[model samples]
Target: MIPARLAAAALAAAALAVLPAAAARAEVEVDPTRYAALGDSYSSGTGTGDYFDETCLRSNRAYPQLLANGLGAELAFAACSGATTSDLLSKQLGSLDAETDLVTVTIGGNDIGWAEAVTACITPLTDCMDEIEASETLVEEHLPGLLDGAYGAITNRAPNAAVYVLGYPRLFNGERTCGALKQPNVAEQVRMNQAADRLAEVLQGKAEEHGFTYVDVRDAFAGHAICDDVAYLNGLTYPPAESYHPNEMGHLNGYYPALSRAIA
Candidate 1:
């Protein structure tokens, strides 16, 4: 309806108004660069690679590292095997500093101390439960204090980081195993997983109490639990090597997605 010259002038002005807004949107991108990880064997990729450390303490393929690889984030994947909540508060496993960007942690299974209890008493269910009961007593007695200390450490050091407390994945599925050893009795196995879940809950609450984010990985591995995947998880019946550790599939496929998003 308007003349061609008039219409063109109006269109040009509108276009100029929107161009600055578009440029602002493009400039408002998130640069997720810094990342750090802390935790136990579940996060450490204990048995996946041939890194060959004196102890099965750390692995190159740990979920945190996998996340780093997938996202191309600079990493400080300090996850270690046999880590406990207390270790988070100490310098035994690794170090923590002030400039960390993102922090992820997985632990508390060893607090239940199921390895020694189950390994030493695999033959007797009653004795295993008794040992677990005793360990539970010890853990319960000191668990809260240890968690408090850990939260204090992370908050004290990386006050600005987005710290995530990752939950442990279920280690066994029903009556499965690695070999000769029948694995921890099914009931005990359930108890152990439940204990780990409880520990995660405690850690999550504690982290929140200290201003950190907590990511629950238990529900994420629902169907893919050791019982469901015959090939993926290390079942006790197969053998006793990594009876309680995550299988390779568990480390790479199961946890990577759940954890990477948080870290990334």
Candidate 2:
């Protein structure tokens, strides 16, 4: 009777072990089909050559739309052009909920006055480096705290979601090009791209602290930046506001592939 009892207990233990493995497999098998995209102009597809709304400037060619289509997920696209981190906290969080399974964010540019810096760079007689330095200071002093707040809110609203914080590509190719830029120099371009890199570093640190993914697109845009033969980013557009934003090809080829690979 003792031998028989020992055999039954061992069998029960083995069954329990198998149960956990089975449960893990079940969890892995569940598809992420409810996705929410929240961020600023880069995520909104501004300068992508098409717009859903003039105010928001979202494009069907945007990476978020492409990602949703590829994954067959139901999407709630809440990104908007010119939206800052504060705007995201106030306006975009409404699209997220407990049931959301995936999220992608691309903010912090406007918060650090990226547009203003570019404007300063383009205008003659203004010290572009000074403006750029001030923006960098803002990035160092305030951007991290803002990101923490935004990430905290996102996690609170959608606890189950896998969040991905996407970084910006370097706008210039580190070379002078034919396109007439107001700055018209490689040094300023390099400085601006370095500032962008710094911003990405801060954002990546925040994402890691919060257990979220950070997708870097810098390498992917290597030869396709603003000065490249086939430029992914727009130089100086008709509307000066559109300057320095990614064009349609940038969204399709650069952002889409980088994000798709990350999720896959």
Please tell me which predicted candidate would have the highest TM-score against the true structure: 2
TM-score of each: 0.75, 0.86
> How well is each residue in 61-154 modelled by candidate 2, as lDDT tens digits?
8999998888667889999999998999999999998778789999999999888888887675666898899999999998999999999999
lDDT of each: 0.64, 0.84
State the lDDT at 134 in candidate 1. 66
Regions of candidate 1 where Cα sits further than 4 Å from its true position? 1-32, 52-56, 92-95, 124-126, 175-178, 236-241, 261-264
Strongest candidate by lDDT: 2
Model 1 lDDT tens row, 1-264: 122322344565566667877663553333444667787777777656544453645666667777767645677766667777776566432455555566777766677665776675466434466766765665677666777777777777876567777776666554554345555667777776665566666767777787776777776666676557444455554334456566677777767777655543
Model 2 misplaced regions, further than 4 Å = 1-32, 181-184
